[model samples]
Target chain A: MTSARSNNTRLLTVFTILSVLFMIGWWQETDVSIVRADESDIGFRVNPVIPTNQEEKNASWFRLNLKSGDTQPLQMNVTNTLKKDITMKCVPTVAVTNPIGQVLYNQMTPKRDDTLQMDFTKIGPRPFTFKIPAGKTMVVTQVIKVPKTNFNGAVFGGFVFYSNDVNAAHQQSASSSKRGVSMFNQYQIVVATVLNINKAAEVTPDLRIDRVTPMAYRGNPAVTAQFHNTKPAVIEGQQMSFNARVYYRGGKKVLFRNVTNQMNFAPNSTIDYVISWGNTRMQPGNYTLRTKVTTGGAGPSWNLVKNFTITGNQADKLNKGTKRADYSWLIIFLIIAGLMLVAILIAWVYRAGKRSSVKNAGH
Target chain B: MKKSWSTALSVAALALVAAPVFGNVASVQAAGPKSGDAALSGVGYANTNGASGWPAAGVEPQTASGTSVAGIGFVAGDLTLNQVPVFDFGVHNIGSSETFSMQPVDSAFRPQKLSGNPITADTKANAGVRALVVTDSRAQMTQTAGYQVILQFSPLQSAKVNDSGQFLDAKGSATTDPTKFTYNTGTDNKPVTMSGASLQFSSASVNPSTDWNAFIGDSLDFGDKAAIYPAIYTNSGKSGPVPAGSMYTTQTRLAAKDAPAAVGTSIDEGKAQVIYRANMKTGFGTWAYDFTAPSSVTMKIPSANQQTGTWVSQLTWVLVDDPTQDHANPIISQLEQ
Candidate 1:
């Protein structure tokens, strides 16, 4: 009876400890989850401090109509939610279209269209890098002075806010020992500031095919067609289709084709639509590019054809630079191996015949 | 009599210990955010069901085996990015001379129950699945132009630095500089890198059919628009006799007009790939790009450039307003009205 009681006591102790540990671990896990969730929320948010002349009361961005030579202070509330003070960089950039036909405002000092008379970066104050206190909202003010020369369309630009705290997190992650494609995310918030000098109806949309060239796109050989929206009116709210085809100058066969549907273009921005070569080697010859753009409505449409030539040197350089697998050495090795096997077989046959002849002679 | 007493004491002790654990779980469940709680607004919660609307604002939680398995809240947003997956390629042997592929490990931020416990939630659970999610609640009173999420990456760099000012891999192997580590595109300089390394993602599904329906027309069923296979059918030009439960199915084509924006694309390191794009008429509410089974979200590593240490990279997700839309003119017209 004493031994049995001892065993029971031990069992109870062990079970109680395990249960307590399990509960502790569960509680710890919950605490960690809550802490992680809080960490994810430890960033800054931007709200446009709408001016008296702000057009849209509910819009998150700034939309104002200012006359030429009008000066106004554009302000945004940068609220840092973290416990520690954070530094943020404010980049004022002109809106430009990317290769994927989407307009981007985060690009700084992007090449401005030649027809863009009113540049937003020049009109707004220079880029500001300032610090915000913890749990405090800092009013980041930029004095916008419209150009004296009157322009017919709107000037699209934005103030892109990037937190240094996020970059510090990136640096910390980069310095850690974690391996194998570990990712650190950096967040950016763009507050678009649209300045309209004239009415939208007064401006007409014009698109021009600026240039075409053979270039390396995403590490692959591709031909980029630069679509430039010359006029300062946004070409949007309408479905547009772009069909680009490449061929040997007069040949009817299409060598490569890229048809992109439902694309929009920004006002006074250039979009470089890339046509992938699909691993085809660049050849030295005259090539023709035929591009057709159509909007379902009576909007602007174009069918343009351009002729260009690639030199032998250019083709050789491009083909060498492309990331395609080069199996020339493997092919040569396989061919040589086959020839050697044939030679070995012949030598063996010769030796066998000689041995048979010797044996027969002895018999 | 002594043996029976010992046994009873042991049982009592166990029951005493276990009762508290169950009690704690119950307390946590009771303390969870209630449905239609305005305090939980502007925050993102996991949506296990294909149901629409905010999870905290009166949306029903998913019940599994008569137990509530609702998603916990994480991250803040009005036009907010709720979750972005962390792709971890686990440990591997060094000096591999052949190409290999790795799938991302299960996410660290998997959906938790109301008791702050992790359940084996399937792909239906948005937070449990390893995916990317973005929620947009910016539209009010009037329709807003959509947004774009651009993905940009950098080459894999060493995550550690030794005392000698050299970058160290996970295995304590040191390189002179972190820049020496490169994501080899096959024809590059001689360095420690995973040759021809690339990341690809597919299998995209969006929530709140109302957002998609507003753009793709109400005739087609959104659930049937799975990314696995393109389902194309010619319009019969008439509402003929249809099978049961297939009333909403109509002439669905995989063209740009009949579908949402493309989400599946291979991302090259050091280049910006537009992973998700919502044009003028679509991409409202929340959308997730599921990287579950069958949907290939893989990291390809060639054996020739396999280094001994852990490699790290930066994935910067840039969310911006669509530049094509004129933000000023519309508001100006509203003011004129």
Candidate 2:
């Protein structure tokens, strides 16, 4: 009975220790600060040409459904509250996925991407110009004609409004014997317009995971997967989870592990998704990378396990970049404490057994 | 005893293995699914480049002028009026002198008898206007005291012309037939003898007791009136008040010598708007002492025999900004302010 009682006490002690350790691990504080983007500097605002309804005053983007050879006229209103008259110009641009897995509107100027088939000029208002008097409003219109040929998926572009005042001021200064460069504040307001042509055509979501590269993301060294959303259909609401484990060419021990989630790809674009690896050094060796992605709703899930070698020079170059991560020291301490508790359990068993035999002999 | 210890060890091991799973669960929750119409609208900056033409010179002061196009970049400095106010005193009996006064039309304050809707420079999209906007992007504007906006008009003129444009006569000689009437010039196609037409302005009759609405820095007292004198440019190209419809340029800067009654003031900043009450004038063609006679902007034919034909005049507005220190090209200072 006494042995059983001592055994219960010992077990209780072990459980109590385990609970305390777990509580300590959960109690550690994590530093996080979230700041929203600022919008005070934006000079002007853009709305869809046709308002969805009177209740919803300004629609942000155009969602058009059309067939081949269909012609639609797009109209929008621009207002200038500045004291001076403002001349506005419009241009076409495409959406590009940046390294951080976010969609960014690229202003098409000097260079045009070849993969983009939608022509902004064919839609009528490539370089539209209008002047809005101070505290006045001006309305502009553009007509779009879809090609007769059948095409699936969505074509994305934007009517980017730029100002001419800066250029005019620059010209005036250059001709009028001014010694210093005339500084001009310039801006662009982009109204995204998406055209979905032909319901009969196929709009597939074709994604290709090219390679896993190491790069710096937001001042942190991260492992990124370079991929392309080749299809015209935009892939959104994606619940993607990537697990990257680093190990030697023929070793069982993993040197580092990285995981990332909630990644999306823009329509007909290429992107790089950075994996979060907390404070792990890049070592020179052969490595095997595994990734698993499950998209939202009736979509196919991906599991790819691949091997890639990291040369000495590559590791050295990557190590020089800035990497931000938090090392969990509490985890290490808990792990060591667990081991010690296991050793104590073994010792308690031996002592209990000895005590039990001695008690039986005395009885 | 051994079994219990084994169970406890297993539980601890499971917990050790599940630590990473907790992080994964948090991430999954944070990245909730989002689909359908992948459209996004955000505030973006616009920058374009082009040249705009100035308004064309008019044939006569009373004639409608062409649209004046001004280009504004990110930082804009200008003083603009929504539109000009026209006072039309309809036809009256002959040999009788009629008098009228003019006051501003604002939503907050309404005139007892306004002829028609005041002309606004802005289109239908934006129809509200209260004060002038004066922008200064230079770094020095912040260090110095703010600027003021003054308004002055030329004396009633028989007729005149300037390099900027032409001015129509305030009154013309009478004609036997109204249908054959001509403005400024006579129906005989010649300059008519002056009918001794006259225009007098009283200081702006602002309600000093009325709290400042939009004007930022200027101090005004209750029932305060800003003086408006008959200052006109002479026929020989000098600044002076003339007998007939003379030439007077409302000084763009309120601080200039012959300041017009200040309608607004702008402080040293991006959007510092000062508001003032619209001026009031009596039916006798003089600035009203108060709002007693149903203050209305009236035009009077003082001499019934003056003109059987229609007479016209013009008011031109100039809006420009330059850094005080930049004298070489006062018009075109740095674009980015």
Candidate 3:
């Protein structure tokens, strides 16, 4: 009887252990879900630590006036609000203008404009990645060393900061491919930096028409005028207007016209202003492009004119596969009408001749 | 009686000694700041002020409660990007030329007022649509010269693999290069891609505070205090006349400065296209661009290029500073003079 009681006790003990293990596993699973739910709301904030030499006291961006060969340290504070640690990538890039005339600061590697005297990427901060601990703030510093030579105007650039952890997580989740189309979204923050050297230099903004070409824009036939801002100063603020017209060489009739207002230009940048030819087939001819520009309602203005030609081969290639107006039926009807009129005229002459011959025979 | 008197005497002495010690502790606590308390030191206040909240269907700012969608949260900055859309092109048959319309699934979060009161009892009425929302509070500090939002696209890649090994399921495995839209062109299988894969928008609306009605009235019709701005680009025959309270206004229309003829803009892969632009003295508070109609956003796949399996792409919404505003810098003008 004692032996039987011991065996029963052992079995009961094993059952209790198994039940405890199962509860522990279930709790762990629930805990993971809770952590993931909290992670969805995780975010961070970054702020520029302005130094004493900042030119604008109330400016949110970095505006500094420094001499040639001056060295300064630009600092920013990154604060992590979540309990888990996060990694961030910081990229310092030079500013470039987009096609629509907006100054873009987040391009990793942008094509340098032809008239760019000084490259900001060379003197600006070096790109780097750093980590911040959970619920802590970290200071990121980048040293800017100006060249020995003095330069005019301002060197425009910006620092782009984004969380590497969030990107990695999204990439991992997006790896599993599915049918159809899937989309992923990302967010980045940019802080503009303007470094000034020669404050006494003149700020003269000028614009010139580089070239005009006929090409396909967005898969549609169009004429594009390339406008080059050949100066170091930016054309901004004042309401700027652009009026472009295309015409046959030396002809008064205008073939195409594009008018745009309030557009701005970046320093030493080029913009391709497209004039679309909607539903019209490209024709081979000599065309003249005339462009007029006015800024700030009554500010500065320019009238530019250029002559360009389109070849037959170019027109044929551009018009290939494009729907055109069909004229085959009209041509066929004209040919048939001309033949019948000729036949009726011959019949009338023959009758006149026969009548004359019969009169002569009677005489 | 003697024992009770002795106990009272002892209690009185203990209270007298403990009072000064507690007072000293309180004074020390008052002198020192808490561990988490931070002091921001700079010449100007940091623009890192968090966004107020998401906007409701009525276009009023509403705070989110509980769990929210991924990448939907408060970003502490004067210029904040609140939300971007997740476009889903539903499953279709393989190797058949077809034009697919976007089946946009709205990921709406529960909205609550700043006072912690629920905006609507039924959250369904306040469901979000396929739109991009941005908020600019820099105007509060007299910093005008608004911002620009541009869209950049990456080529669609194969995101999933089938058990039959028909689709290559490698992560970020795109069938086309960054510049083109043709998918799986060089692969052993037939390639698939749409001719014109574009994201079209029907309207761009702005919801400003009621306090600025007088200033807004100068440009727009402010018959009712709760009027929204006019659509920047309205699809033909899709939108009606502006309502009684809400009048179409040009107060905040700054996109005209860039593309005077911006309607029906086309997008190319790996190229940045300026979708929305705000110029000087415009684009304040909450703004959204809606693309929720059937034909508003579309992609056409030729029957020959439709290879079976899922295709994927990425659309990056970038908010950038306008260079035109840089010319107005007080210091730069001072130097020019």
Candidate number of the best lDDT:
1
Quick one: RMSD of model 1?
23.7
Cα error, residue B81 of model 3, in Å, equals 2.9
Comparing 2 and 3 on DockQ, the stronger one: 3
lDDT of 3 by residue, B109-205 (tens): 2111112234221111111335455555443312444666677776555433445422342343342222222345535674444332445433322
DockQ of 1: 0.09
| TM-score of predicted chain A against the true chain A, for each candidate | 0.73, 0.61, 0.74
TM, every model: 0.59, 0.37, 0.63
- Candidate 2 lDDT over B233-293, as tens digits, reads 1111123331221112221211122111232121111111112111111010111112111
Residue B316, candidate 2: Cα error in Å is 39
The whole-model C-alpha lDDT of candidate 2 against the native structure comes to: 0.39
Q: What DockQ does predicted model 2 obtain?
A: 0.01
Instruction: Residues A264-329, candidate 2: write the lDDT tens digits.
Output: 455677765545343465666766666565665676566666676667776666555424232447
RMSD of each: 23.7, 38.1, 21.3
Provide DockQ values for all models, in the order shown.
0.09, 0.01, 0.10
